[model samples]
Target: MRQLPKLSFWQIWNISFGFLGVQFGFALQNANASRILSNLGADLHHLPLFWLAAPIMGLIVQPIVGHVSDRTWNRLGRRLPYILGGALVSMLAMFMMPNASMVVAWMAPVLFGAIIFALMDGSFNVTFQPFRALVADMLPDEQRNVGYSIQSFLINAGAVIGSILPYVLTNMMGVSNEAPDGQVPQSVIWSFYIGGAILIISVLVTVFKTKEYPPAEFNEYKNISEAEQQEKQSFWVTLRSMPKTMVQLAVVQFFAWFALYLMWVYTTPAVAQHFWHTPVGDAGSAQYNEAGNWVGIIFGAYSLFAALFSIAMPWLAKQWGRKTVYALALLAGCLGFVSMYFLTNPNHLIVSMIGIGIAWAAILSMPFAILSSALPAKKMGIYMGIFNFTIAGPQIISGLLGGTILKTFFDGQAIYILIVAGVSMLLGAIAVYFVDDIHAKSH
Candidate 1:
């Protein structure tokens, strides 16, 4: 059996740089999508349902992209093709997403936003799943942790820039943050345009700069026969034979993602109501838009912290064990969410974000680091894609149930949603204790 070669630090960085752009698209969505939906007159109760499109699209698209990328090989390389194609689609979606309310006067904004959200998310998943497999493809086991942490670092770095774009456009550049009734803000519009352009350029850099091993060479590295490589395995067969660690990690992923989904769907409204005293029905109010931009700043803070903290994750894992570090990170995130209930000032939210940032860094790197060691190299793409189901499935369930839970139990107060997220994150922390960390054990 031939061993895969270790990648240089620069080579690992080149392979991971495309994630910077993919995440720019995601950060823009995460920071602004709910604000956009609310601006278009979406009721708070139905907001989660509108957000549902993202996870649903991700659940369906990632596994298919993974399966196809596994079989695919071309001059642009196996993963770059999907990366570039998805970048193009995401760029288009970003440009159109903020304009959703204006595209059709008769179509409801909520419905239009849902369609655009799905497109952006679908494209992101197509691009994202390949990147996960790329790390496994290019790096040996000893370096996989470093490769994934670098990817996480770049992901959060891009998110920081993307999350802050609107705020910078509004506050720094003096662009108008408030739009007329039923219209999107100029600051948000420009942010999306800039984010889209950056998304393309960053992905193109990875496409042209990074090289992939040829299929024959890749097969040799993985120790798979040409006949075995040629034969397609059914998804079910591969899924049924999944390692125990994958199943255990899935439980952790479920509650963690469920907590995150609540934060993403409710944070805008919660902040607007709690900090700015903006009413839920008054989407077009200047105070409401100001609160939305503040959410962007808070998102940027957390992302910036995540980028800085991710650099230390490999070292932290070595010292504390991956499972323990991950569990502690989730506990910190729980406190972050719970802290939101007590903050009266918007700027003070940064303290809460510090905790969330630690968790975000862990969430991005730890699972992939552990999972990569357990998965077969030949089936890396499919397994990575399957792992996304754990992410998207919980999000889908949260989207379906969140609005109802808010309306029935919380009396439509978004603040209570954050409390629920805090509790869910605490449960996730406990669940992570059960995951078998093969990498940690081996070390």
Candidate 2:
């Protein structure tokens, strides 16, 4: 086995640049999926049920893509094939998601939108899970933090653009925010159209620019023994022998993803009810649409903060260690979620977003930085795929229980959902304290 060479900054950048577009599409989805679903006749409580498609698809798709890509080798490259394929499908999904009313008339728009949501997220998981392994595949141990932080930066930067595109179209270009009954707005539609284009182009850049090593060389660089390569490893076998770091990190990931799922599904309705004063089930109203666009603005603001915060992650990890930095970052986000309860002004939401963004930066980079060092190189993809279980599993639980929790415990006040999400994040922060980073840095 040989030590892998340190990747140049541009090489690292090209490898991760596609994530910008991936997150861009995701940002648009996060900001507007609920709005689109509600416009198509989904109730507030039903939002979680409809949102279930994302994690369900991730739970099903990521591990399969990871396991397959691990064994695959072709001219298109192992990860790039999946990356390109997923991006193409995601682009098409994005193009059609906002236009659900016109996608098919036989099915209701809400149902159609959920289907698109699943397709988009499924494709995203396919691309996303591989990129994590690719970093471990390409970089030496020392460069892992820098590599994943750059990924975090691109992810958030794309998110900023994606989140605010609709707002920019509506306010800057004078496009309509409000649509005809049961239809998506022109501004939102165009945002998806533009986001789709960016998604494919950015992925193409990564596909062409980044060169994956061939099997002989990769096996040598990664120290994959011939015997290990020849052995057929089932997903369950991989799961059972998974690293201790993976299991420890799963506890942290579960709470973090569960909290995020709550926020993504509930934030729009929460804003509308708490500040915009729109009546329940009035997703079609002008004020409700305005609130939806505002959701975009604030979501973009958080992405902006996350981008800036990601720039400092490597340095932070160096000074404080990955686990400590991760815990502190989640703590910031937990406090941010708690702050949302007292936010009377829509503008003040940006303050809360800053904390959330700080948390987002760590969530994107640190765990992977920690976990990648601990995973076996040959099974990196499959292990990374299995890791999605932690991320997807909790969100699945959140989706199943969130609506009922909202209706049963909170009596339909969406703001309380954010508060509950805060508690979940706080738990994540505490859970982080328990994880052992195998290659941890310290003061």
Q: How does each model score on TM-score?
A: 0.98, 0.98
Q: Considering summed lDDT, which 10 consecutive residues are worst modelled in model 2?
A: 434-443
lDDT string, candidate 2, 1-443, tens digits: 58788889999999999999999999999999999888888888888888889988988998899899998999988888999999999999999898889855599888888888999989999889888888889999999999999999999999999999999998889998888888989998999999999999999999999999999999999888899889896667778999998999999999999999999999998899899987766788888899999999999999999999899989888887888889999999999999999979989999999999999999999989999988888888888988989989999999999999998998888889999999999999999988988778522
Model 1: residues with Cα > 4 Å off, grouped in runs: none
Model 2: what TM-score? 0.98
How does residue 402 of candidate 2 score in lDDT?
A: 97
**Residue 389 in model 1: lDDT:** 94
Clashing pairs in 1: none
lDDT of each: 0.90, 0.91
The positional error of residue 371 in candidate 2, measured at the CA in angstroms, is: 0.5
Error of 2 at 196 (Å): 0.3
Decoy 1 TM-score against native:
0.98
